[model samples]
Target: MTTLRILAAGSLRGVWPDLMAAFHHQTGLTTDTQFGPAGLLRQRIEQGERCDLFASANLHHPATLLQRGLATDTGKFTANSLSLTARRDVVTKNDTWLSLLQRDDLRLATSTPLSDPSGDYTWQLFGKIEQAYPGWGERLKQRARQLVGGIDSLAVPTGELAAQWLIDQKHADLFIGYASYAPRLIHHSHLQVFLIPAPFNIQAEYAWAMLTHSAVPLATFLSSAAAKTILRQHGFT
Candidate 1:
């Protein structure tokens, strides 16, 4: 059996193994997957790196691949939203999620925009904040530290959650990242997880692209009930 080549978003790292195992059991086809920032992965594909399937954290990346003729088709498979992870000590008894974000004393960390969908979503959230409160959004954007998910960002230590690790290391007082990570991040005693509320939150739509005819089956499988169940188990919608 030929091994399928897959390029996936780093957000899927914690769940990919379970998903792949299920795929293999159902189809007997194995996969070799590479996980990274979706935008960077898309750049690799555009720069001549071949993959049978490309799973991105956002629909736009795979849709771009389809538009460029690099992919045969693209469709959404799962969804996620943003969350605010903060150092436990920073959150006060009276603080709401919005209050924490507006404080000048806190250091905000986000992924690198344009190189990661998470960063893109964070910026979108900022835009919403700006629309509601004049000048606050711009202040948040100006102060945010783009600490990871760039082409040259520091490598997160093996098996560590980026939000937790960054906070534990004193790199950030608060982090804005995918809510899918909240289940794990919440388990950390020193970290607090806050789901961004509606009207202010951005929904991240994960999309998959078929690079070749051979990848069609896998792509179809990914949209099945079994796959969605696995995704939900991992905190995706």
Candidate 2:
């Protein structure tokens, strides 16, 4: 049996274990996986890391690979959105998403931009927030703790989600990350998940490409409704 090597985004970590198991059961093909920020994964591939498939949290990375002739083509297989995840005990009862984010005393954690799409999305959201309330964009960005993303995110322990662990360590009062990760933290950690309403929400687009044509079946399977159902069950919109 051939072991397909897959490079995927970190936020997908929560879903991949079971998803890969199901995929293996269905196709009888073994897989070896690496998960981290999509941009960094793209960098790895650019640096000549061998991978059979490339799954990214945003369209840009995979499209970049295709443009550079490193991958055959790309397909968007899943979707996600950004949300504010706060430690339940630390937030005030009346805190709305905006209010909580605006609090002067609040500490916000975000992924590192340019290295993680989640951070890039958070920056986009800051722009949207500025449109709603001028001057707040720069304020939020100035205060946000870039705890994850870039090469640093690659250091996050296996099976341990970054934001959840950060909250547990009292690093920040809240964090902005993929909504897909929110559900797991809420269930397993003392966290509260809040979806940023439309007008402020940044829609996250996830895509994948075949670095090696032999991995096409895995890409097709990921795009199928069966895979989508599993993703949705895990909180990916």
Best by lDDT: 1
- lDDT for each residue of candidate 2 in 155-233, tens digit (9 for 90 to 100): 5667777777787778888889888877677785478888899888988999997999889889988988888889999
Clashing pairs in 1: none
lDDT of each: 0.94, 0.87
The local distance difference test score of model 2 is 0.87
Query: TM-score of each candidate?
Result: 0.98, 0.95
Spell out the clash pairs found in candidate 2. Answer: none
| TM-score (C-alpha, index-matched) for candidate 2 | 0.95
Candidate 1 minimal-lDDT segment of 10 residues: 151-160
Error of 1 at 75 (Å): 0.9
